[model samples]
Target: MARKTSLKDIANKVGVSTSLVSYVLNNKDKENRVGKETADKIRKAAKELNYFPNLNARSLKTNISHTIGLIVADISNPFFSSLARTIEDEAYARNYTVIFGSSDENNDKFIKVLDFLSTRQVDGFIVASPEESRETVLGLKESNVPLVLIDRYFSDIVVNTVMVDNFKASFEATNHLLNKGHKRIGAIVYESTLLHYQDRCNGYLEAMKQAGIVDGTQFLAKVNHQSLQTEIQEAVQKLIFEDKVTAIYFSTNTIATEGLKQIKNVGKKIQEEIDVVAFDENLIFQFLDVHVPFVSQPIKKMGQEAVRILIDQIENKDQGIINVLLKATLETKEKLQKVN
Candidate 1:
């Protein structure tokens, strides 16, 4: 392996003492202990040499790992990927590095990831999808491992979290479909015990009831991740052909995309025979012939808040748990008329 650039090398290149170079690079010269010209020369040489700080060495000196563990549902999904990117950028600005892992919404894997990160001495963690990992999260709290949940949270856990109000978001999105003159609406969601999904499910039910559609069970379908394709096809066929549904509300972007594909395979035109309103936003929705309505949360804001909360806990800046609830924005391109 190629040798890495060291601070000593920068000091030697600039004809300065190693301690002086360290003071300037670490920005510890606020007292003007080192001359400005000398500092500038050290910085220039460091940049020229592509100098990078050794995190391990710094951890030993400062007792701060300066690394954060980020565990999310699925990084491949646009919503999670975009949110993770925002969190990473925010953490970088605070002199922290981000290490990522995908839990695939599996509780066992999520716990394993947390343990592994703990072993590596990460300062804290920003986690999402805590439905089945209730005990594990509670354990983290008991252990005083600084952690913040993003995207999903458990009321039973008493932990810091940053997320949009899933219930209100889903209710508004479902109401959007209802306002477009579609009475027979179907909803597709992930089959989970998580509060996030349950909140969305309740929101859809509330809207359907408000619209005088009492038969809620017939219009909703839930599927696990392992059997997404088959279940999506089955749900779409049943909802469209058997139930004569006019529109569908997808609780997430993942479910929406799968539902769209199933609709196409069943030879249906979007907004013509059926309209859709998804809970999360994705760029792929723009390319569709049908103007798929979508709800977008403050993804960047949530990410930044997660980092700030986790860092605060890690530094003992906050003594109490913080729960941040944000709002969602609905984006619409076209409205669907009632099917004759």
Candidate 2:
């Protein structure tokens, strides 16, 4: 293999000292009082020599790996996949790299990934923590590790977090269904201890209460992550047949997809037999016979804020804790005709 080009090679070609080349390549020329013309020549020579800095050596000297670890619940899920892409773009724009993993909503796997990323010497972490990972989050905080929780977080933990106002999002979705004459509406959600899920459930309950429904909990169904499809089908059956609900609210996109499938299996059509609203938008909803309305979270903004806050924590140890709750909008094709 050909030898790797080095800064020394660029320096020799430019007839400059290695330190001057380092200053220009590292973007420290202005601070070091190097002339702009000389800096430009150094940059030109470095490009011509195809010189790539040794990141490992630089990291060892500066104590910054310039890499972040991102852990989400499920990478295949469209919401998370989109969020990850946005984060990657934002991080790249800021000259940082992201290494991401999926926890599969398992606390043990979440901890393992955390440990693995920590060993890789990541500068910071952005995580959508799994249920029952309170101690793990606390441990990271206590260790002074730079972390920013995204999409999900523990309410009791005092740490940096960037997430949507799930409660409001759910409440608006539930209220939208109610406005369309869906009094006996039901909701399907994961049976997780994560505060984001709880907030969503609470939002639905509160909206039902405000609509004069005495006990909305009776219409609520919780499904486990381990048996998602099966549980969602069962929940949809019970809500439609037993509870006699005229509409359903799905808390997550995965739940919405499975519930819609179950609805089709039972020979029910959206907005015809039953109205429906989902928390996160999905492209599939648009192609259906009748488009489904959904709560649209600002995914790009959430990812950008998470990276910004985590990088801030990594670079500024004295920065105060930050908690950001972004708003979500209810998106629909058109106002639905009132149910008879």
lDDT of each: 0.82, 0.87
Candidate with maximal lDDT: 2
**True lDDT of residue 251, candidate 2:** 95
Error of 1 at 301 (Å): 0.7
Model 2 segments beyond 4 Å from truth? 1-62
Candidate 2 yields a Cα-based lDDT of: 0.87
Which TM-score value belongs to model 1? 0.79
- In Å, residue 28's CA in model 1 sits off its true spot by 37
Model 1 segments more than 4 A misplaced: 1-62, 335-340
Candidate 1 lDDT by residue in tens digits, 139-211: 5665566788898887777889898988898989999988878888999988888888899999999988888
Measured by TM-score, the strongest candidate is 2
